[model samples]
Target: MLDEAEDDRDAAAPIDMLERYFAAHGWSHQRDEDEIVAKVKGSWTEFELRAIWRADDGVLQFLAFPDVRVADDRRGAIYEAIGLINEQLWIGHFELWSSSGILLFRHAAMIDVEEAALSLEQAEVLVDTAIDECERFYPVFQFVLWGGKSPREAIAASMIETRGEA
Candidate 1:
């Protein structure tokens, strides 16, 4: 029984598992041998999330591009707000692609075990957390990008909590 189970585990690929997980959640996704791409809609924005599985490193990375490129003039403010926003994230953080001025969120996990050993729930969390973090901080980026707000002000604006309906 042990040998059979191990064989089964070995037969399942991580990419396949992730593809199935994305399907199970009713998400539209595309996958090749190395990566899977999905579009996730957050409260503030719609973003494309890419999950790349590195066989050699046993690491899988989920990245979400918020579709907002920080303009050259505003990169400074956005960069500062990203620093503040990153401090609040528990699982993933934001990053700026310097060359392209693109802002994205990234979350990664190391699954040293066989691909079959990872459950759909585990994969879901990775995507969910990445999307959630992006949703949470997108407003901060917008505040800095569009509102001409200072980094501290943007962070503060994004952090406001509402208690009840007015």
Candidate 2:
């Protein structure tokens, strides 16, 4: 059994590890209380990666926001695309903030007390997964929003696997 001081230290360990991870990668980040926000440039676009550590619940919620906005008229199509995209994802899910019409990817992991700390590799994987998924599916959203393609069509186009470069 650990005392309050030890418990508190354990709770903050993940965030501190994340801070170090971000700094090592040369990603610009800001830490506020239990949250850290970092700016990362993905292949498709820029992304804002945010992580919030919940001390009481020992949960770490990670989010990646792609710099894309959906128009009011395209919400229905975007929502459909999100469903299709999320279906194929194993770790996280994509969500559109209805009020702001912004698209973001979100995932959460539980850090057990026994574990007590988040490893740097785990932090790297979390961030990489978010950005990779965002980059992979960004054009699908673009196809639906600006190219006037159906959700299925957009997904199909995005799924085309390219071979070795010419």
Candidate 3:
């Protein structure tokens, strides 16, 4: 009975649920303490997703880092692009790590400690949303970084919606 209680407690941990979700999807991941790092491949690029569960605070902070870097010359434009991009997102936001010029999408969800567990569907949606946002905005960053386009131009170019195949 004691062991069963312990099992239930372990199952309720957010990090453990996230780990199981990653494994079920066959994504490469490693868990250390209260964090799980996984590599997810998106249409535009691959991303490194790091989810940290703070049980004390009952917050799950998830960050998805795309395999793109901002150049010193393009930092200003990139920052502007991020601002515009973030405005369109209903959930999560883009961040540029100034020190490293690394770009990432970050979101945090508050979980009720009493409940303690997130449904597998919730976990999937959390991860999918991050990846979807990254893929959606990747080309905007690329246009600014490599194409030397202005922030407005980059946003416009990336926002074009095509209905069917050419």
Runs off by more than 4 Å, candidate 3: 1-11
Off by over 4 Å in 1: 1-12, 113-117
Of the two candidates 1 and 3, the one with more favorable lDDT, higher being better, is 3
Number of backbone collisions per candidate: 0, 0, 0
In model 3, residue pairs whose N, Cα or C atoms come closer than 3 Å (at least 3 residues apart or on different chains), thus clashing, are: none
Model 2 Cα lDDT, one tens digit per residue, 49-95: 99999888889899999999998999999999999999999999999
> Which runs in model 2 stand beyond 4 Å of their true positions?
1-12
lDDT of each: 0.78, 0.87, 0.86
TM-score of every candidate relative to the true structure: 0.86, 0.90, 0.90
- Order of candidate numbers by TM-score, starting with the best: 3, 2, 1
Residue 132, candidate 2: Cα error in Å is 0.7
lDDT of 1: 0.78
Model 1: what TM-score?
0.86
